[model samples]
Target chain A: MRKDRVLNMLDNAEDNIVERLSVPALTDNEKERLLKMSMSKLEGMSMNINAEEEVRGVDVYRRPRWHRFVSVAAAIALVSGAVGTGFLLKRSGKKPEDSFHAVVSPEQTTELTTADTVSTDVTTELATENTVIPGTSETTADYQAIAVDLMKAMNAAELASSGMLNTDANSPLASDSNYFKIVDGNIKGFDFSTMENVRNFLTDNFSGKFYEQHSYFIEGSDPFFKEGPDGLYARYTGRGSIYGWDKYEPEIISSSEDSFVARAEYEIAGTTFQVDMTIVKSEDKWRVDSATSTLSDPDANNTNNSNPYVSLCKSKIEDKWNELTNESDNVSLDFVFNDLDGDGSPEFFLMYGNGEYNYQIDAYTYKDGALKAIGNLPGSHTSFAVDTSSRKLVLIHAHMGAGDYSWYTMENDALKVIKNEEFEYQEWGSNEATSRQDINYLSKGCIYKIGDGTVSYTQPECPINEIPRSNEINSFTLDIVDQLYASAAE
Target chain B: MTGNEYRRLYAESPEKAYAALFKVYCDYVYAIVYNKLNRVAQREDIDECVSDIFADIFFSYKRNGEDYADLKAYIGTIAKRHAINSYRSLKLRSERFSGDSDEEFASFADDTDIETNSDDRETRSILISKINELGEPDSTIILQKYYYDRSSGEIAEMMSMKASAVRMRAARALEKLKKSLAAAGIML
Candidate 1:
């Protein structure tokens, strides 16, 4: 009880403490400067709502997305047929090819140049003024670096010390979110007695389960490092009913000479939360040992919890295949393609659909002339497009209500995904509804990588495209996105 | 607090948010934003970030975002995140990561010490001292937040964090900071 009191006091520290830090009013010039920029930004954003039209001759979303290795096509019919062809077609317009690319423009102004100049970054004047001390440029760099290292050390320590961290204590709904470690693996040097027994022990004591073995495929060029052991290990975090809302905290795993802990941060009900974990040296390699956790605010008030509806939705997504039992205005679908090798044939992709009605993405392989379920990924409704780069098999997907689309790279046989970038614009809902609703759909599209410098995708104008307007959206975001991705990928 | 509570505070009590900023910081909001901006960054971005500093403070409090624990820590994270986001948009952008050459500035990922002795305060002190030697807002706040346990929003309200972070600036700032410091022959 005493400990709880102290912790609670700390949680509500602001309520009891006197205010710190002083206030500075915005200067008149500052106010005006801010207003002008806001207006310009708003104007620019509005201009982009219908900006990306498929490059006139360029084709997008015509090939497999998560398989960049597909350089060899049985009939790689170039959307432009040739690079210059697409370029020439779009070049006839007033906008340059640059508009088709998402290159950050030079006209963009910044504050770092408080010295009175425009730039893409904030003005250099602002950057300079923002310095810790008058000339803390060098010092500031050092400052942030130290902070990063410390956090890493702390994170490492937390991993080593507790092995796992729980995101919510009130709801004891556990999973591998807070903790994932090699509870078991087929290490080459060590016998089953040295490690398998320990693994067996964990399997018996905790709610242990085997995870899909994601063997590390480290390249000589990759930056991430992994030490110890052979084969692969499966891990998961545990959840407990300590708090009102479900929280998955890190779980510890004991290894022979070393320890490895794992935790997952997740978006629960629209907020991000994480579990803590640690791993330490065992007699041989590292193995996980323990976990600690903190609860999130969303779990505070439990009477209105919507787990049943949310869970029903989530479970449908996790399943590899499920028939559409019913339908409503909330139905949405997205496609996901995965290529095991750089070569394109026999690749697998799924149709992931979700929304207010019933969310399901039916993935089928075209074997025996009938499409059969292969996989599924559920979050919200999804929108899909493809990117065929020599380096990666990329799929750009936007889950419903997600401000940004995520990038999933199909390397080896696994689908490695990460949130990529965000773009402006939303579509208004125009589907059948017992109740009227506003939609922000941008999925009315397909992407085609026509050539090295040209690509295109279609984004519907939503209500405008469906109602009164007779034509489909004739815009392409690829010109902008391709430019951005090209630069970033480089 | 609820999101509604946060919205209400942001609307009617924007000054309350600003007041919170004042409480957490002395006059650093402008200083932090100034530290990261180029002339190209418009006032709107800075102002939005400034206003958001407060919103993040309150919402983050309600959210209890833990990548950082204290207000100072949160602000520094926010400011850096915003700055980096803005930098990507800048035309004449100089490589911010180019000049950092300290070893203590190295990241923990590069560090071999997986088993940290959390019980040893001396060990923590060595780390803290190494951080102190690094100096600057990043140093001041990263330590106060990550090492000391602070939140990015609290840091924002204090004018310590930059605006424009989708999530807290990649939680790797401390690791990077430590690597730089260590390279400078400072071992905390």
Candidate 2:
């Protein structure tokens, strides 16, 4: 057997064995160096999360809810500026019917207005007493529009709070935007020049318990923001980069004279979620009271059960199990599914052994709804080895201090022999043996005979023989396969 | 750190909590990644993998918002998976540019092998028991020099001894290990 092969096995030994072998303590300087490196990478990930458009190929997940809230709070600090006022006024001026029609498709309009029609009976009666028309299509459209506006305003607040809107140098909030400041290449503080602007922004967009919870505007009440002599300032809270919702599409689900519940669909990190926002009229102005989100697509959240790839694997395993069981009464079959080629698809590895030292393996992958054989290894004196980094499968057969090594790789859905070598070992008297060969493989006509503490290359007396590929599945029972599958899944 | 302490610290200060978490578990994470990728990857790759693992753990904790009863186990699982991914990526890239012929196959073989065997667990257990019997600096020397593949100077720094002394102890320890394994009817 190869010495490196034995060492690799020991590298992945049991947890107790590993712990015993890896006992050298790291110096304090080493720990500090590693910590600094980790912190830098994490900071980079955080920046990518907060970016408006993810860096070209970077993979980012959704930002946590708490960070979004803090971003909105920061945006509120700039409410006194012209950018905030212009955005609010531009949004408020659009007629409810016009805004509703512009924002949603005709099909969505019908669905949302249908829910309003059933719930607006009481509103119709109240409208009849006044000069307003009762149960008119315009009235129903108005109700849906109001709910849509509240959702839009909340989303706008999050965008502005995220610092995406005022990034340009000419923007009005750029120079005086003191709510968040970068120091030493980090966003470290939250300090506003005016507290009244934040209070007004919060009061206009949020109300009731939701507003109370976000009442950092209340002097000396919340620990996050403080009203000191040098404007309203907050200590650095150590939160990562701030991000806003990528998109929000709201449709009124139900409506009444006083309230409307809107379902808003939004996308973050390429995944969609639906948030049900409850909007209520307080002091004659619509405001968002609360909202809760659920994943929009069932399959996106439960891939293991619905994934077609998993189904294909399970089906093929069952077929192979039946075929093996029909051929023999006592057989030992075991298998594992791994993405050996880093292709994001697991390849099936089926092993048939005699419950002793000899074992054979056959690898298969699913393509066009059929199992395609990718690789295989015949039975050997020891189990086959997989080099995860190089994606090579090695088989070694050893007996009487002689061994043959065959290295295989998947090429065009077939295992191709990449390298082959044979070696012989001899021990002299006094238990002395030659140092293991550190040189590269010799030409095909040469063989390595290690002895007397020296490595010498000599022509082989006979031609070297290659190990034959075994692509056919050896018949075996299913009991061991089931256990192996369960273990692999875990 | 206990789950409660981490939660409390996270609430009070996330930066402080991250520092505490890294300080407590960096070595364990480093060892796991280093052992898996040492032969195939460069030192920089190993360092980057360790950092990526911690970043993943921190974000996962933030996203799940659940209290981990066993924080070490959670960290260990993430570390192992990340190391494997790093190893695969590095290996694939190297294969694309490698220019070795059959004459270099033996050296190539020495650099690539990552096999694990449940069948060998019992034998490994016996071998580890023998190594532990060699005692203190000797045991550490053998493991650090052979298993970890650390240089004698590096092992000396960790054990606070001279490099020459570390090499001498390692040689003697290997002899004792061989004799001990022979007594158990095993030969190297």
Candidate 3:
């Protein structure tokens, strides 16, 4: 073994032994004895007048009730003022993008000036007045500025962490709100006091969206939020906590007078996803109307939309097909470019759609000299989009009252099913509701990716394991119905 | 209480200051002794070692002016050195007396001495002294990373640095430690 390894092992062994061996807590008598002995020793070192009276060990951290009240009130005032200002700014023709920029500016200001002033003041104070040392910064104004800036920064940070700041370039239309209301709950009304509250709120609200999205894509329910036989909770019971601070790199995709689309990408562990948030002027404050997440393509240059490389890909596919088939009637091919393998070169995707609904998907890559067909996903009558963040090809298939979406990727010259989920809403509850319930229906069956090219099929159970299974499929059914409604509306 | 608070009270009301300091750091001091002398010393021995550590702290404070930027670190140094010294003496005494009986010597010979001997103690002490010589954050980093086994993320949190930066610092500190150890003829 290496010397350092041996040493660490020995040290760890010693630590383990020490940990295992019970060390009794110091008894009251022992503590008093030790305190008295230590005090006497301290006194003997330098005889202070009235040493006996001074070392009484009284509680030193006592404060009047008014002081606590004032502190709490001040905290509340600061938070309320900042939030109110944020809302006001949004109302007064200032975008959240502006607020983000403003939050960043103060941090830079504090960083530049805080150090010099604080250090100089500390040096001067330490050299002169030895007793009255401020615990934080040098001056009250500096402290206040820092605290206020911190509050604003923290507000942004908290929002970003809660996935509220996670938005993409896509917006859900007003007509499709009910289908997505469970997925993207109105962030306007939620509280952001503590990290836990933020996490719980997201977990509670987004749990349905997560289960539905996964089930639709045939991905398993998140282990953290899953309660039991029922897949997700009816209401957000507000239980458990999620770890990590949310950090995002945001880009303003587009903006107008009443609404703006913003894309914010965030990374957790190593996986990255982009959230597209659509903010609309609701009453006075700009509220998040809808949000959706997709895989963030780090390599894809979205800025330069007219990519020459993509153009080259289109030319190659069209030229090759024209040479072979020489038929273009009633055939329309749409192109979407992305880098699936992280090789810096863009993967070319062509959707060969007939004038009707049937579309055949083919993926191509440029290697050697000519264009090469990497793989093809035999298409059905479906709508499709690429989740650039996760590098997965998403296919949405809706027929009659059933909707199924599958996430596919090319691996080893073959199509790999990452996740496939389908849901069927079997009721005309919108018309034949005795309880005036529109779109209320029964959702049945779910399937998710269990492994590479493997999927597990099961019915989603109620997330809350406490109560006996009652109205178990109600939430999932609503989500499925919502999905169908969204598909139809789109 | 903060380091400044301790320093102020140490200069002014020495007894109350010591009381406050002891109240906060007694467990910390005891933990060092307990770890260093575990399985080798009795409970009484650990208690005595802790008391000795406190005496050393008191004397050091009295000798030096009130400019302790990190009181925990200062106390850690004293406690570690004193406890290690106590453990070394106990180990050496056991080794010396083992030769008194042939059977006892045979049993002792079979059992490998994992605890530090006299030579190991000198090297360990020298290594610690060199770490202290490294000063401030480097010394603290080495102790926290290697001795306390704190993660880079945790160390980063404490130091208000990025985890990558903490890892870089730990690497640099380990390199410096190796060089210093080689110079002291420890070479580990």
Chain A TM-scores of each predicted structure, in the order given, are: 0.21, 0.33, 0.25
Per-residue error for B183 in candidate 2, Å, reads 2.4
Per residue, candidate 2 scores C-alpha lDDT tens digits across A1-490 of 2242223446655545655554654666766787777777767765664241222101011111112122222222222222221111112223333323322345544654454343344345434544322433335455545555555455434322322222111122233343232111111111223456456666876887556535533433223333444444332221111112322234667766667777766443233456677877779877778765544663453336544555655565566444533432222344455444556555666654322112345678767867777754434232244333453444443322323355655667755667755432221000111122222111111011111111111111111121101011111212222322232233
Which portions of model 1 show Cα errors greater than 4 Å?
Answer: A1-336, A339-490, B1-39, B42-44, B49-138, B141-188
Q: Write the per-residue lDDT of candidate 3 for residues B1-188, one digit (tens) a residue.
A: 56688778877887677778877777677666766654456566777787766755664455433344446655664565466556544544455456676443333232323334456545555766677777767666665566545567776766667889878888888888888878877775
Over B1-188, each residue of candidate 2 has an lDDT whose tens digit, in order, gives: 97678899999997788889988887678778877676666677888898888876676456334455557765765676567556645654454335655332222234354554555776788888887899997887877777666778888898899999988998888888889989987675
Q: Which of 1 and 3 is the better model by DockQ?
A: 3
Candidate 1 structure quality by residue, lDDT tens digits, A29-131: 4444544443454445335422322221111122222111111110011211111111111112222112212111122112111212122122232345343
Give the proportion of true interface contacts each model preserves, from 0 to 1: 0.03, 0.34, 0.05
Q: What is the C-alpha lDDT profile of model 3 across A151-248, one tens digit per residue?
A: 23323323332223312112211332101012222222344333344455443333333323222111222211222131121111111111111322
Docking class of 1: incorrect
Candidate 1's DockQ:
0.02
Angstrom error at residue A101, model 3: 68
Q: Candidate 1, A181: how far from true, in Å? A: 61
Quote the lDDT for B83 in model 1. Answer: 42
The lDDT per prediction is 0.29, 0.47, 0.40
